[model samples]
Target: MRLSGRAALAVGLAGAVLAPVTPAFAAPPPVTADLRADVDRNGRVDITGTGDQTGEDTWSAGRGAVFLPNIDDDAKRCRTTGPDGKPLSDAKLAKCNDAADTTVNGAADAKDLARLRTVPMAQAPKDASGTVRVTGKGAKHARLFIKRAGGWTAVTAKTTLTAAELRAGVELGLEGTDVVRDRAVWDGSAVVELKVTAGSTTTSDKVTLHVAPLLTQHHLQRAQRMLVTEIQGKGPFSRAQQKFVKDLDTQAKKAGVKQSTVKFTKYGDIWAQDFVEPAYAGMTGEDGRPRTIRIMLRSAQPDREAGRELFEKLRGPDMGVVQVTGVKDSEEWTLNSMGNLETIPPYTHGGRSYPAGRIIMGERKDTGSKPAKAMRTLLASQGLQNPLFLDTSWLHVGHVDEFVQFLPAPGTPRGWRIGVADPDAGMKLLRDAKAAGHGKTKMFSVKGFEGMPAPKETIDQTLADKKLRADNALAAKRIKANLEVLKRETGVTDAEIVRVPALFTRGTDEGVAADRMPLLRRIGGSADTPEAVREYGQQRELGKPTGPSVMTSAYVPGAVNGVLLGPDRYLAPRQWGPVIGGKDIFTQAVTAAYRKAGFKVSYIDDYYTYHLGMGEVHCGTNTLRDTTKPWWRP
Candidate 1:
């Protein structure tokens, strides 16, 4: 009956479809002023920027408009908060100046102000002054900024503008990145109105605010730039990790995407993609082109302080990095959130086309341990991606990127296909290699790390291990279960799926350590434990469906979990399968699969770096793509 903004925005994050545009509250109160903005792509804020001259009342007929919240400048460190507003180190000051931002409730930078769409009130007679006001339940969380010679001033509810101030500029901004504030997730819907009177003439105009969905993925493959951590720390594996960064630069150049490397001199966290994801929000303007903004979303689980500082390092023009955190530390299990959350490419499913695709995360069907609630709520509030929950409780790391990925398939119905792990195919590949007389060839014949020697086993020996074989069989079964969920949700059939060669083994003697278990679990008992490591008393009592100790891991680098370079290039983790003659049989299989699907495969050696850490190329790098496509319908 009523368009309750709070109730509508608070819908369940799992298996929930957010309405792209929340309709105006049933029969809004009559507007009393003239508050104009560039609602149309005509390059000017005027009355003609609408389907009809009824102003915001005609929003349903034509309401394609939006503005960035502008909180991304908080990317770098608090350099301005230093002594005398100066940093101790000159280099640190330089870094801060590059991304120099304002206070939390301060004015926007020059670039940010430019990108912020204009909010101009109707011009009044020569000496006439007026007051511009914004109201509605959605107005509380956003600020209506007014510009002056000193700086831009922020007003939340309402403000009076002198004739000169009105002419200077007036704009709106979000107080913070998250749509879900302490109370409600505010969908950008505020009625802006202005009252002006002169020579016995009083008039007004009103319009509705347009909100843009902060989106990620498939679009990220269209990244203008790519980034990976520069692991400068000295270690036995440092050289190999540095080589990995070089490899990323090489691939980026080949793909024509700019490569950015951050000095991880302190943290040495080479898993760049895990800490942050690339996203964007914008609206088309009068020039028949998109007014784009580059953004990065830092993961909710701030396990690494380096990640937060890294956000400050990554901030640039029209670009910002943000993290929506909770009041307290997120559950340790939520560490999987960033890696688990990924997007499927644009596709039509069940007679509907998702031009911007869907948001997916690795979550259990019955179990409740997942990403932070605030993080999920913020994502779902965007509305473009109807987020889905896939079962990944079977994994040791519990990430979706480990086993499943989306590829550009021009020939497929949706112009894309899902690449998923197939343990059976892996076994078949090994069996075929052995049958070809390479059974005696060493499987991991090369040293994975500098000090550690390669596993002293041949293909024949590995195949002989009944437990290893059984591990793969069970892994394949679980993969299929998640695949079925994907099929049902995305309308993807077997024809649209690509089977990737993958082997599995129980990695650690105890799969998930007692420390990694989810918080608030009753396990073999019925009491909620809110702390991380204290949740599970004994590792064997972990309430995992695959028994207590089965933490399935990729026996070799899984090819599906690789970095995607758009227009047909893929960077897969180098498969260290048995080398027969000049080529590795496993490498040959992986290459053939991707090559057949119209993508050229480049092997990235992660054995010493990420593979040893139970990750691959995709886990090590993050991409920012071209996402200016209009997500709203006519």
Candidate 2:
């Protein structure tokens, strides 16, 4: 049989699977008696056979060679009869000559060394001079890759072999047969590629690899997404909005951000400044029961210094709702005083007396003083130690612009309906006129003070007026104006800011005629048809039908229901104009903001009699551990 270099390499490789080559006809076969009796080693019979014994030893392993004991003093050669016994092919004769021509192990000649030199090596890449390729059955797999001199170049897997593997020559194969037809070639300085397929799966073994560029990797890891909070009417925030700000620090910490980074800013003290009542009615709790609220106070507004710090610490953790609180700072008042607030029991109302109160009554009657103290007491009762104040009074709750812009828009619940009221009488007059119809006269009554008795309205004329539609435009303006103020204060211009239009200041009695009243009044009362009343109070019918306004300045049921059920659109009503309770409003607003930002949210539902009674965290815990060094505290 003619032995191909490929086949020889394969057989050779089969012997040492680590890195093998095929077999060659140059080696003498074992089992021959001629070579066996002429035993070179003492006491050993080295029988060997010449190859190409195809017909003679077709199915047997030891057929061509045999050994027998010899009694002669000198060794003798054993010869086989030509075609009678084991016939040797010309290839076999040449192989015998080659083996006989050489020492058993370097026992003989120059011809054997020359034959070894003729073995071929697996080739590298075609275009690339240094690249080499190799393959084998159960070959030790290794991945190879290169960074091209100038730029990245994609190459096949098989073309590149490791330098170490290249140093030690390996056998190559194609479809299990030893062949050079399927090895890899180089492609210049660019990467050389090769592939080996087994079954249906192929791995990137022996690939031309490269190093990654530093510049591109750096920017990809660090890039932020701008959100804007919309303002409704009057000031930038209510007390509840402030509360959200205060709690943001805690929220950030809980979300795993560093404490110093999470922070807030005070716009104006809710206590010190006179407040504007929210433009809607609010809920009437289980009759005579005091409502619970919370807020956050801060000494400074969160800026870039704080922002960057927060950004680094926040990393990817999510912040839930922020909270705000007002801090009352007066030399005369002490934070530790137990008698600072008065507790009131739940009073009976709507034929029911409910349980309530860790009610704190303060001696100072200042509305500003009450909110701060109430907040402090609330937080303290909740076991919050070292809880620093945000800022006093002026708590405007907001967040980073990027965070808000990414938040999804608020959605309405199914079966949602609209209700309206005019905390200000402007909307009421328009509603009454619309109900009264063109050019009509009607009777109206106004409540009187003390024993003076109620004033009887003998005649009130209603003009059939198209100008009555003015209320809608005014309401829209109020919402727009409110939002504009917020936008200016926040510096968050990215989000789309759309205002709810068509609300007006309602008037008491047949008081100020819509025509006689000044064009811009924010509050008052009105006597309109109940349906008109509903329309005005809810502010839903003023324009294209929209969602109802929940809480408002007006004392109306529609507004109350809105605050409870339609949390997304409720307006926080201030109790006494300038001095108002803000904890509830701020809390809800902050919660809503967080919900918008893709956070997992749920109500704080703990037994917070003492804590909540003063208006504090019913659910959240402060996760901000002290990181300050001992020396820093002083």
Candidate 3:
């Protein structure tokens, strides 16, 4: 039962005053004692005390007290009825008498009940197979007490010390065959008080215990290492791709950055960053060292096999691997770590709190309501108070990195700013390039088409240009809609969003006649056949039927999909231009925009494989960063 401060005080005072007190005299020689408490290798607190004294002694223990001030009047002892059926009004009188008794006994005053120093206590260490050793000297007898929600209780079953081993001038072990063996008192922190009295002289000592936590995952500091994978020459990587890798390595070396490159196998595993999540904990490893654990997500079979390979190659006693089950795709795990918070997609069951507490997820209008509700419930059950959910279904690839990114910005009002892709801004640059006589090139004029028939020399390119413009306009509208949703959900103003120029494009379908011509080598038979000329003439009349396409970024690798190397450095995809009437305008504008926001931009070419596969540089790499702040504070 819970007790009011006054009620607790009344009860304590009643016991102390009613007990008999021996007559006071000149204090005997001061007792000398030493106390030590240590946790050993057994997850137990082994306490011992040793001291010396002369003559017969009396041993006692005083428990620590917790008092609450300004208690309700109705709960005060003075306002309550006593056993005599009368209102108890002797609280002040009892305190005065108790103070007199303390003065008579030559002990510390008991007038102020709130500031009593009874016994010291500490939290136990949470490490496995560890023990706490507590020793005390200069005391003849020792008593141990553990604090709980109700109050302090003696470590031994009996209140009085009856064993000779527990008497003064002897080394006493508090827990073992001779002492209490209950596991309850050993769980939390304990307070041990040793008191020895010789010929009316008494001395006491107290010591506290503390235990450290085993796991912690709420810190996101500077990145310590950049992780990449070899291309293995499996996909179509041009010389530009090779140059991009060389440039990246050169820059990294110049910065003295450490890197880990996973050897590429024949298996299709180019994106190393999207598979795992690194979480730090305070537990000792098998080799008695502390480190982080890599929590990998397995989606498809190939991806799972690749993840297992990495895990087996890198796993250690300190650096372990944990697999997250039932994930829809690896893209769902592409999260932004923000110290105590992580931005991820809602795709898991309830009760799993990853990367610490707070989570920011996105909601798609296309996903059914029941699934969304279940995901929300799962997140809430994991103690995520207010998760930020954005609408990302408008884009062809519904991933947050395709549109938004968070980076360190010391100069901004907040320490960081969110970068959002702006297709409208990209279209504006394209329009300016077209006005300067850049967008007049026909689709048939594009290089690397051996079998396609030559386009009519007199054909006008205006319709093709208009179709491209229409695609960009549609992309701009979708991007605007997503921005509105982000602003409404995140409460981040437009001023805070750094608009990066980017665009999107739809994949070409093979069934369409226009789509098939670009990939075909010849429409009819060989040059020897007479029908070849006639077939070519007829094909010209079909005339690139207003191109079937969708909304895609102007740049092949989206601008927003770039990776932030650090607070001041960013690595983006290199855009080859002069395709949309804009010769390198997309790259130039993107570089200028990032530079204006206090970041030095480095362009890395990914056109051959990564861009073609609908990804960017950030999607292909991962980083291990140091955590600067504590999760509890944020």
Candidate 4:
């Protein structure tokens, strides 16, 4: 009869067998009496039995033993109890003199009883896959069962173990596939119980199966969903900004990908760029199973309320958010294609370790400083062997994204490649444009500020030309140095590097200059006052009274600061009709470059919303990739 629910079974036997000893007196037969058992779904077993022997019988309970051949050493034996409902001493338990003698067993073995024996079963690891192969001796004709809420449920129909296979000692595939469909049943791990019956004796063994966690970012898979914050332009959306969002939605729809728009009210909150960095830390749950998602957030920002609201909307069983204690923004963190998270060490509350599968990559610099030491300790504890460190102090905003990015390209030898912004390449394009009669292009044409006096006009024109040369030269030098560092540390070759056109400028001391100007500019004053011109030149001391400032577009908005949607798709910043290369060459060059690199480029015009704020398309957007790849393969 099949046993279901929480009910137990009890069998009573009243048979006696005679034992041979002395010939003179006849010995009473040993009695086999009632056997009561309670087996729970959680592998708890309890048994109680009684035996009676009377008149000249040298029969003792010690001579007979109860055997549980299948339980492991941890749960192999049963303790004896007295009639008073208390555990009996081993010495007192040995004397079974009366007909009413009884033997009681505990849930698990405690006395190391001689009759109880464990089966030699190959148990799987705690984090084993859904399907585990259980193999061992005496496994033939075994019945597999899974522990459920009400009681143990037999899974022989779903299992792939035949009598022949078990007899041959072949591994039996225990199926726990229902975990995917019934998540509430199995919290990442399941227990498989195998009951094997040989003749009249039955034995059981158990194994735990674990399921792998979800992958968030890595070369394992490409992003299928793009996340963008809805433009609530406190400054009012420019035509370009409006078109950018519309084009993004159009492209996403065409690619069969979903575009998730995070809503916010505040103007400063619209720059979702600095809020949270979506990452999967591969953390384990309370039951020792991998957690699905962990969203890393920045501790310091201009608008925390906006980020918090967005995080609340995004948090679910498959996703969670963790705020980093010492970091100012998520721009300090970057996840490479190899599943390695690169981050800068924060000042306070930084040192924390992560799990094994997810690698943390950090850079060590300025060991003498307290913040640097803190960062070093954090990265060291987090299990990074050799972190990639580059000097970003020269740039107004020091971030890895400003200079480097990783792209997926199956056609490449490594199946991936790195894109580095080349200021020199941008300068070369600028020089070519100037040579082709584009030098006279008006640099800045604000409505109220047009048609200035002779000295201002000359100074503006000179400063614009000089700023381009100085900024490009400094940026190129820095890029060269950084490239060397990257090559030495990561072993990435120049052939695998895609040089994208980009430029940088410094922020002024007073923070007024939108773009930096060169130190030298000959301002021609009125021809009447030579003395006035000399005094003006002395007061200026070349051009800048203060220092250099943040990066601004000379000809177009940040072209290289585009988003890589997938292997074949890219979203580049549209030029907004900027006169570069003697024509509107920003769109033409950027599009051609991406297309040449085997990407279908989609131009996004974020000139007014993001570019005016010294950021680009990528700064305003993010992507949550598909985690279909099996992490075990990596």
| Candidate structures ordered by lDDT, highest first | 1, 3, 4, 2
- Cα miss at 302, model 1 (Å)? 3.0
RMSD of each: 14.4, 34.5, 21.7, 20.8
After TM-score superposition, the amount by which residue 159's alpha carbon in candidate 3 deviates from its true location, in angstroms, is 23
lDDT of each: 0.62, 0.21, 0.40, 0.40
Best by TM-score: 1
lDDT of 3 by residue, 442-466 (tens): 3222233233343432113432455
Using lDDT, give the best candidate's number. 1
- Across 336-398, the per-residue lDDT of candidate 1 in tens digits comes to 446678898776677765667788887654456667777777777776676787877667777
Candidate 3 local Cα displacement, residue 292, angstroms = 5.3
Predicted structure 1, TM vs. truth: 0.78
**Comparing 1 and 4 on lDDT, the stronger one:** 1
Off by over 4 Å in 2: 1-634
Clashes of each: 11, 109, 44, 8
Error of 2 at 619 (Å): 20
Q: How many angstroms is residue 58 displaced in model 2 relative to the true structure, after the best TM-score fit?
A: 49
Q: Which ten residues in a row are the worst by lDDT in model 4?
A: 33-42
TM-scores, all models, native as reference: 0.78, 0.18, 0.52, 0.53
- TM-score, structure 2 vs. true: 0.18
- Alpha carbon deviation, residue 450, candidate 2 (Å): 31
* Candidate 4 residue-wise lDDT at 509: 45
